[model samples]
Target: MANSTTAQALQNITGTIALVGAGKMGGALLTGWLDGGLDAKRVVVIEPAPSAEISALAAEGVALNPRQAATVDTLVIAVKPQSFRDTGAVVKPLVGASALVVSIMAGTTIASVREVFGGAVVRAMPNTPAAIGRGITVAVADDNVSAAQRATADALLRATGSVEWVDDEGLMDAVTAVSGSGPAYIFLLAEELARAGVAAGLPEALSAKLARETVAGAGELLHRSELPASTLRQNVTSPGGTTAAALAVLMGENGLQQIMTRAIAAATARSKELAK
Candidate 1:
């Protein structure tokens, strides 16, 4: 469920909202809006292959691919980056002249969005965790976006998780590398940790279970704790203890930090390339 501010913001939108895709991330956003008290009757979902879950939404009053496209107040583009052009051509007519366009498709630029749809655009990067409403999104809007439009975008994005805004769109590539792709890094960590546990003579199943639970529990702890991550690390590490020994290797000169820096730089570079 969305926070109070997000819920109120969703309830406040009186005009029609059209979601252009119903994949995992798009479906997540639709669920968030409804769960946050937005009226289902006001939404329109445009998807060529709607899942059973998405098809079910029509029963609740959401318009599912109406025979004709009508101008809408907000148009959310959540299609795959590679298919955006074709999808944009189909959905462009649904965007009113004064519509607010919010896109969650990574590597798609605000300039490209405006070129296709010609509305006040907000380009956002939201991670996979959004499916569970625990993601974090970073957004940047084009100059034409009004204060109200920006707020509405905020509320919509916040339905799935926390939101941060940036003045410079250039920062979006790095943001995409960090939080947008960060979950995969954590998942990889758990995967490698499980392998290490297996190498240490633990049963494969037990090692996998331990690694999964440890990563999940630690993430939850970080979520609930007010302390900085560094402080939390210190709290767990005692002098020459097991955790400290592991940290010594992970914190070494050619270790996780260096690897992660290079990884993010590569991802950022790829994002920039994709934007072009």
Candidate 2:
């Protein structure tokens, strides 16, 4: 992972950025790209629905729907999986042989994108927190992509938070389950933990606050620390303490590990099903 300074220093390279959708993930990327020194004039967003974000882009002089599709340096596909058939038709012209196509749609294969775009395709999956610059994106690209194109794609994606590259395309389903859909799982955990705390007699507001802050702070600590998660857990657990007691229940057989493994398996299978 690039440190904050390295990530910030990797900005300023410029090129035409055409986002074929203006949904949440696409809008977050557009925000990050602009923040990372990409000129609004060089950016084109094509969203027929034109949400408030698309309207804002229009006000900033970004082309909404152009008369003709022109070749772009980079094309970002952020439409939904169900929408790709239509999106493929709409975005084909902008994707010249040389353009690098980066897609953030989950379960959509790079081969599928190449079939439509006819270019160097990079499959990416970015989380929602990218809107606030705390997302992580995992990308994998075709071998035809040049080093510069890879770097450009990395920089564009890193603007959201951190970027990782995976070699095996099959692993993307697991990545999607772990990160793309992972945030919702964490959110659910926070909600359930808060409710459990409330049921255990803590004040409603206090339980909610504690649960949220605990998860957030733990996440931050994990991010900042170099130690492994197992070490961190060991460091926090004391013999016969509350944390230890909790772990006895949570870390027991058929506990968190088993539950989580099952959950991830289910999600991965669903991702494969969706791809089909």
Candidate 3:
């Protein structure tokens, strides 16, 4: 599996790995790396206000805010987009000139990262499911990124989940809309499905439980099945059935597809704006 490969890759890395900002996503990546057999002794964490959980890693030999910067091989930037400039300035001196830089900050461009870090940069967007190692990430590297560095970046990103590489950076905006921001849309579907169930006279708690289970189960089925989503939906809907009645309303003109398209467009636009 990809996870086992990532573990082997982590074991192969000889140089020090430095992580900036140990927040939710960063914490998830750290957990993935450590869980994937990366040595704690080779890790260095740069966090101003470390949580108790992150601080605990220090006991395992991971460095925490050392006075001097070590020669880093890979530097991961996980700080908030708004705080990147300030954070980058502080961390820039900590990284070696040839260190491979991988960034997960939304809307942060490769050029932007290079301007601050001046390394072979890869910009990636990962969804919230990465917390559970089910997330998918899309990444693009600059011309300066060597093949080995790109492979290394892929291995590192694959620690949490699947990785997709794209030659065009322009697609990242749409990728962010579809994947990075996609989980929220699915969550909203679950929320609205429960609300609709309540409107149909189901008990509130029961409606919530049913909606949650249905969405989660359907997602799991989708993951396991090789069939297309449309085929799966067709398989579930019998002619003149209750699902058919609902589909009559949902598939009508100006329904879910139209709304979803508009939503994705809005998100993509917002991503482009934030990049500026």
On TM-score, the leading prediction is 1
Off by over 4 Å in 1: none
Candidate 3's TM-score reads 0.97
- Give the alpha carbon lDDT tens digit for every residue of 66-85 in model 1: 44447889999999988988
Backbone clashes in each candidate structure, one number apiece? 0, 0, 0
Worst 10 residues of 2 by lDDT: 1-10
**lDDT of all predictions, in order shown?**
0.93, 0.84, 0.90
Top of the candidates by lDDT: 1
Using all chains and alpha carbons, the TM-scores for the candidates as numbered come to: 0.98, 0.93, 0.97
What is the alpha-carbon lDDT of model 2 when measured against the actual structure? Answer: 0.84
lDDT tens readout by residue for model 2, 1-113? 33455345445555667888888888888877766656678788888887875687767768777443476878888888888878778778777788888989888888888
Candidate 3: Cα lDDT at 54: 95
TM-score between model 2 and native: 0.93
Instruction: Name the runs in model 2 displaced over 4 angstroms.
Output: 1-14
lDDT of 1: 0.93
**Comparing candidate 2 with candidate 3, which one achieves the higher TM-score?**
3
Clashes of 3: 0
For model 3, state the Cα shift of residue 230 in Å: 0.7
